[model samples]
Target: MLPLALLAGVATQLRAEEPRPAATTDFAGLILHLSEDPGKFHSDNFVSNEPGYPSAIEGLRALGIHGGAYIGVGPEQNFSYLAALQPERAFVVDIRRENTVQHLMYKALFAAARNRLEFLELLLSRPPPNAPEGESSRAAMSVQELLTAVDSRGASMKACEQTIDSVSARIEENFGFPLTDKDRVTLRHIHSAFAEAGLSIHYSSPKAVKQEPTLRELMLARDTYGNHVHFLASEKDFQFVKQLHARDRIVPVTGDFAGRQALRKAGEFVRDRGEVVSAFYLSNVEQYLRGAQYAAFVENVRRLPLNDRSVLIRCAFEKPTQRLPGDHSEQADGQFWPHALLLQRAQRFVELYDEGAFLTHEDLARQDYLDWTSGR
Candidate 1:
């Protein structure tokens, strides 16, 4: 075997020689690819402005995830994780094409805005509060203060519509990605959701029968030990995501997790850049995957570049009595709630696959992978 120092040097040399995705075409290609794919698109809006899932920061931090590629499904929660992980690149894949359009809208706003406050101003269709003209002035305002400023001004339907149209047009004209009529209409509704609701937009599930927490509440939510883990909870956290957006590092792709094309192509792109997958956030999608779909997803994941440190973040819903290690929950009015976010090493999943141990979602969920760092 090669010496440790020699192996490290060789790895660094190989990374230096790899080709990176071009800034102009990387995002455009991802958008166009989703447009061409055959994945089923949902019509109704599935906007998740806040993370409805459990927090995985403790696991990610323990795994030392940084400066690598991130893959996940869903909305703004991805930005929060990206802010924390500071990945070189990120791909947000969802079955619904509307999600892709929503991300495109975000990309346009990020390209247009100069900072966190400016981004909020454009997103909420409201002006910023009067403050000194400097970075310190903006940073001094807390997340609550920012929300209050936005809510103080009622949603301006006319102004918000104009801004949305202008940004949508810029996305097509400047970014070179064409948007369909339906996409434009859908984008407008998404913008209205944020503008009208401000930070109070709650997580609305298609299958939900009851009310859920708003985005603001989720951001301020603490873990069992009273720790703030949401991405926008701090100015430093907000700046981290803003900088990543400014650099065009976050790309949204519309593809099913079990599909043949998207994840495979993403793996190819990461491999060409000589980077490994640091973390993947699978937000309760596995619960709906059938046998064939589950197998296909595992096969696709096998194609991605990963190491022992590569981790899978999964969310599961169980009874409060059936909680796993590191699981966090809250009790409301004496009702038991069981929501678990688990992190496991990628290699362990590969092992389970080889042994035919993952025949069902329950099989995958019941494992003690939550104790991910014990054997390592």
Candidate 2:
């Protein structure tokens, strides 16, 4: 193992980007071909905890970010970026095989439902949306109202049981991708977590010392203009992601950022398809990429096809030094908000590294990035 230092000789070996031959295959074959074997990660991130991710929408739009390949880490958070950018294609790359398995669960959910409300029914294990009872037509309700209605009804263990079986069947029918027994088990476990917890499920369980934001809160979150911006915020946004998943355009791969193969293969796939990666949701993965690993990660990034408009989406998080009223929800919940999404020019990242500006993670969070986000 290398110490936490980048060797100058390794830096000197960086070469210009080159294209790799495209593999001709369907969605299942593509996933199996592109992904590395299962790797280990510490947490079970079934739902995202980034409450302030809507700010990323405003930032990306401000920077004219849109339409190309979208690469991201984590669970469902990438959906919001997909909705905003309307990317031509997407890849969710993470070290955990569980993350990839969970994505298969999501693919099943999207495939089962037609619109946003029906999608929620399949997710929370609610009985199918029925005749007008307590609420009006499902289409008439706002995102907030839909979430509130679902939250009021307790999760049905009976429905959850049925949901798990259906998800398993759907995976076999739709994708036709062969999953290992462990992968199938992981898929069912992830689905059960969402159904049992309903909208209240979070990054960690609710009983933890620091309670994280719930799925309901995350979906209800708003952009800088106070417009709801999560993936389920609007019917159009929801449909965009739904169709993509049904078509298997959004692929999830178990890939270690610092390791070999996965990312490099993804870059090659993008290059061969003639698609440029417009937005990449880093989500603080750089914090873990130090020393030679960081250098290797940077090299992997440089392999992607990019244009001048491409940007990297990252979230900045911390523990408060003193009790300050920055955001009311954190104080009220007695938990820290692990996010405020920030943007950096993808090309600028490579340029800054060459200039010796990104020696530390702190250096990645400079004010100039803020300026760049604002078009200053």
Candidate 3:
């Protein structure tokens, strides 16, 4: 079972990140649709760090659109990318500080709840020598036992609700943004969407607690540290390129190297000059940056560079556990992890672009399992 201390930390991290819309002086109804996997869609829709998932940069160049109120691809993704994409777009929110407290609170509550579930697993399992006395050894359950257990579980769930409430309250007190039920539901909806879409919820853990913390912290820290000095310091660079093209009324091309190359050449003619923001799984970095994998990416890029300018890449971090979908093994049936599929599609894109990058990809879960069994 996970340590109680870890559970608390996870909850803390979540509440820190989640946003409470009602709490803000002004609300921007910006629905950020993240790509669970960039490769899943055609190259014309989404601009992601990965090879597939549609090219946001090209989309901007092709669409001749700039700032918007609704949902659709645009130039400037996260904060840094926004600066480079449209140094003029002022409505951008520094996502890190935007709803941090609420985000962290939700995460912590989830962590605590998950830990309780893990502990219950131990308690309800077949009793062994280490098992507490009077606990049943059999996995099978009688009708009464089952019903009673269900009641107990219901109580536990209620406790979980309280935990979240407490955290939310704390967030309100600290950040001056009190979370209303509506705000909580919206956040939950986003989490549900990510899970349903099969994309990994990167922020489903307390990053600060990890031995090798996920990249979310690195990116956020870099931005926070360099906020005053550099606009694109830590934000991924792909969005910047897209925004720049959008502002110039450049049309973006999505799909196939020939079309993209044509777009790139066109961008130059239209005075295309802007930063590119992109991200990728850490496992596939070698494919884009160096070694044989890099060569493969080059081969693909030669065919289609997607965007027309300078690019920046940043790593994403994992979120607290509860904010993440339930364990995949359970197949609880409500929602599937969309991020996983998103990444899988992204892998496909890399393969389409440069098979070398695809070859370098690694599964984080597989590694974790190996490490655990081998006591690594």
TM-score of every model? 0.84, 0.85, 0.23
lDDT of each: 0.68, 0.72, 0.26
Q: Is candidate 1 or candidate 3 better by TM-score?
A: 1
Q: 212-252, model 1: which lDDT tens digit per residue?
A: 55666666666544666666666777767767766767778
Q: lDDT for model 2, on a 0 to 1 scale?
A: 0.72
Worst 10 residues of 1 by lDDT: 1-10
Error of 1 at 370 (Å): 3.3
Worst 10 residues of 3 by lDDT: 34-43
Candidate 1 stretches with Cα past 4 Å from truth are: 1-26, 34-54, 128-133, 320-322, 332-337, 372-376
Deviation in Å, model 3, residue 361 alpha carbon? 12
In the order shown, the candidates' Cα RMSDs to the true structure are 9.9, 6.9, 20.2
| TM-score for candidate 3 | 0.23
lDDT of 2 at 338: 47
Candidates, ranked, TM-score: 2, 1, 3
